[model samples]
Target: MKKEFAVIGLGRFGGSICRALSTEGMQVLAIDKDEEKVNEFKNIASHAVILDSTDEVSLKEIGISNFEHVIVAIGENIQASILTTVILSELGVQRITVKAQNDYHEKILNKIGAHQIVHPERDMGRRIAHNLISNNILDYLELSDEHSIVEVKAGRKMKGKTLIDLDIRANYGCNVVAIKQGKSINVSPMADEILKEDDVLIVIGADIDISRFEKNLVIDD
Candidate 1:
């Protein structure tokens, strides 16, 4: 069965999501206040509508609550985004994902019952900054404000040590979730799995613990 989704606001973020969901064979309803934006996605999405999302009456008339998931992607208008999210929550939409422009916006969205809040731009910036700051740190993802998942290149000190020998969970307060070598990855690696130089380790734990682990495991280059 195809999952139904409604994307509110046809800006770059919303439009891209609609196209991607449509490409994955989902039923996507794209909405926007601009007729041109709506028309632009006419052939891409299952349906496109031009309406003011802040207006609860208009939303109800269009049956916005019928969709399985609704995305509030209004970028410039924070008020509209918050109102739309509130309305969607009141209408009992199964899931509501909102694009937050900043920390303040994210707090508001969370308070209004948004299921997920995305800081796409901020996240991307953080990733880029991490890569720039440390050559060995391949990637970083924030699981929460405190926890994180990071991919770092295995150092010389780590080579030839099995998972049991390293005792990551016991010593570092983190787990080696995966090992990526060149073109291959071992997910949920066994306790006996050995670490090799140049291999990338995907570790998950609290941000402070992960940072400590990285500092101790990864050699500065």
Candidate 2:
């Protein structure tokens, strides 16, 4: 069966998530307090409803807790977001993800047992910053505040070196988890495999370690 999902809010963040999930062949229930917002997503989501998510009775009526995953994307309204999360937790929802406005909002959501917390804007800003600072970094994904997975184009310095020669893990504390060349990806690449300038390395480690690796090998003068 397709995994079921519920997204509460029709703002950019929530709307984008709903669209992406639906595109992946998932059943998504989109909810927003505004009638217009709900109507906007009527055709995009499996079901779009205009309802106050803070009301536990309404959530129960709609069987929100039965979904495999629920995302609370309520914007600006911190109180409603917290209350909705609390209700979902009490109802024993399997997984609940929420977007936090700031640190304080995140703390409350954490205390209330939100399964995942997303700071989309802040994270995107950090990713953009990383990209701007380095030409070799193709992409960056934050696994946490201090750790990230990065895709970097192998530079001239790394072109002729093997994984063993680089000794990246031992020296930089980062792991080159995979190597992408043209259309193929080498998963768990062997230490003897030579790197090419055009190769893309998928590396994961602490931010500090990644920065060090990027500086020493991925960047060209």
lDDT of each: 0.90, 0.95
Range of the 10 consecutive residues with the lowest summed lDDT in candidate 1: 212-221
lDDT of candidate model 1 versus the reference: 0.90
Best by TM-score: 2
- In candidate 1, position 3 carries an lDDT of 95
- Tell me the TM-score of each prediction against the true structure: 0.90, 0.98
- Tell me how far candidate 2 lies from the true structure as C-alpha RMSD in angstroms: 0.9
Show the colliding residue pairs in model 1: none
> Local error of candidate 1 at 216, Å?
1.9
Poorest lDDT segment (10 consecutive residues) of candidate 2: 126-135
Instruction: Encode model 1's per-residue lDDT on 16-113: one tens digit a residue.
Output: 99999999999999999999999999999999999999999999999988999999899889988999999999999999999999999999888989
